[model samples]
Target: MRIRATAAAVSITGVLALSAFAVPAAQAADAASGKAAFSSASADATSGTTTTSTLDVTFSDMKVNNGKNIAVGTTNVVSVPVTYTLTHPADMDTSSDHFASGPLIYRGSSPDTASNMLISDDPATCTATSSTTMSCKGVIYVRPADGDLMNADAGTWNAGALAVDDSGDHTMQGGLGTTKVQRYSKLTANAGPEPVVKGRTITTTGKLTRANWEDNQYHGYTNQPVKLQFRKAGTSTYTTIKTVYSDSYGNVKATATAQYDGYWRLSFAGTTTTPAVNATGDFVDVQ
Candidate 1:
């Protein structure tokens, strides 16, 4: 069996004795225990038939670091044992079969330790106890560090957050057929709080306006962009409004041109730049 680790994925191929996919192993089938089982030869059948049989197996290149072809600069290794089983059925026919299982392809460390294994291609358990020579395929397990294919099981979102550096541009692809990205808000304890001006009073009619200085506290808040709603004293429904960009630090404000002034709340008028993944900001209210 041959396992090749690439920067993208692990590729596997080879001839085998059994024709089935590898299955995960139970505690009873630990690699150490399996290693012991493959260290002996079989005995003949007890049937009255004059035929007798025996089997012997050996393993090679049981570690990923020892793989023949590996991606350059990728420190991860692929470790999986490759075994060849020789079978003599009834002593009259002798055939050989190959079997491979375990973590299969791993990038770093041993799977028996803290490493993650391949979900599908590789199985923890592998065997060649069949009467005939069984030929099976190799399992190639791989895990990526930065970007990975999307996971459909977790709703339509990707399995992990969209990670972007100060100005890094990254493309996403792969996994479960379709591709998608999951973007999350990037608020941290050290980033400070959203600018909040308690008891903001509004007197004008159009979209509510605010002192630009109050909105400037949130570093990422863009010009007068507002996205929120409100209603007058006797109104049953609320109306939506747009935000105008702020020029002077004190001119920042979200506004609506309605002419009823019983009481109005400041609707946050937020705008985002292109490539929405990096957009995030706080809103302010206006009378």
Candidate 2:
């Protein structure tokens, strides 16, 4: 929402040209963890009954350059200010987009600019085709293909669209409810054996539930191979369990048995035909 520089407790200056700063050394942080937390939805309304028939949003990775020779540390929380301009829905003029600078899931150049910056409606492609009409989805790419550490060589950072569908309130009936929607722009990448278990250090146990994938209109999780890997607490490595398929309700059942006690993460990827990957909805702490 607001873009401002946050000072990390220490600032190293003058050693390098003010604009000649180095990119922070990549750490062992997990991008999947950051994405799962950022790509969530929120709804609001008041008084007579305001409804959001649709909501679309795009995202990008968090980017940083110490333009002023500001020394950054390992603990500095980098903020990626995601900007969105909404073309108010025809029936609703009062709507807002929320959440910014909370996580590092997204880290790359954002396509948002003040002149071309917006939340919902897009000038190039929209059904209404007019500036006055509000659009439902946001066309944002949270990160480019290279940004995903898992497969940096791909060099195909892409854009996907999030869309909310036919949902709103009826003043006459006094009923109000909103349905969350998601759409994945197809991606082409090497579809390999499901994510492998990076070797186990500890024992872990948890259930797997799909969040964003289930909402897409094309595929509904039936007969689809979803692979997930986990590790025990205190360890960064992951271990592959069985390759599970999504059930009718778009849910997967998983149980982890790690060799040691520690933290865990489950990484998801589609089969050979579809090459999109998703991370766990929640982190598991194995004690």
Candidate 3:
């Protein structure tokens, strides 16, 4: 049988064949088990006649929970919610709960396990929104250090959806979309001339980096805006002094006149492609 992954379809009928867009092992197992009972009972059959075309299925309004930019390496367990609306043709058999649908994640160039693979928790649990349309929702986790997409496999990853009737007659898979996120960003700052005279300029320098799935290492981010902020030694609020931009190497530098004994730090507001991050405060003592 043909299973669609991304734009093209590949051949694999195993109970659980991993792919960029997969049926998932749990769902596939359920489909395999359930289909055996009704294999001879083909879909859109009329009086046991063999005149029919394949079942029709289409998807719409796909959404990912916790936002689409999947940032990893900060927390271990990342909560992900999968939601989509689909249209099922009237010809197919929808008489029972023999349906399954979920998301699939693959890393390292392909869906092969040697690179990475992730699947939904369940299949075919979507609630019916209309006679021809159904809305399905499920949750999945991205653990950089522990889950299927391991920390070692850091880099760009892909996500998709697969829906099936499990009656061996109709199936539909979502577009081969990207998570568009690498790894969580890390920021660090250091101040020179710590015990500076009352009027000396305090210089703060730092670096910004994030996960690069291509080579599997943290790389510098270039041309991004970051804020230099400070808080009094005894106070908690941090006041923004100036906005500093990261260089081609993701390096940051800022200078401020020593005023009061307080803490100095750099913050990144982040962008559509990355998540916001803040570095720990660096304390400077003024004489």
Query: Against the true structure, whose lDDT is highest?
Result: 3
The sequence of per-residue lDDT tens digits that candidate 1 reaches over residues 1-287 is 22233322221111111112221233323434333332231211121212122222222323232332322111223332222222223332221122222223222222122122232244224334566333232334322221221121111211100000111111111111111111111211111112223343332222222111212112332344333345544656545544344334323344334344333333442212111111122222323
Residue 279, model 2: Cα distance from true site in angstroms: 2.4
The residue ranges of model 2 lying beyond 4 angstroms of the native Cα positions read 1-182, 185-220, 271-275, 281-287
- Every candidate's lDDT: 0.25, 0.26, 0.61
Ranking by lDDT: 3, 2, 1
| Candidate 2 worst ten-residue window by lDDT | 9-18
TM-score of each: 0.25, 0.25, 0.61
Q: TM-score for model 3? A: 0.61
* Per-residue alpha-carbon lDDT of candidate 3 for residues 118-225, written as tens digits (9 for 90 to 100): 566445356776678778776666655443443454445555455545545443242445564446788999976879899899999999987654444677889899
lDDT of 1: 0.25
Judge candidate 1 at residue 78 and give its lDDT: 31
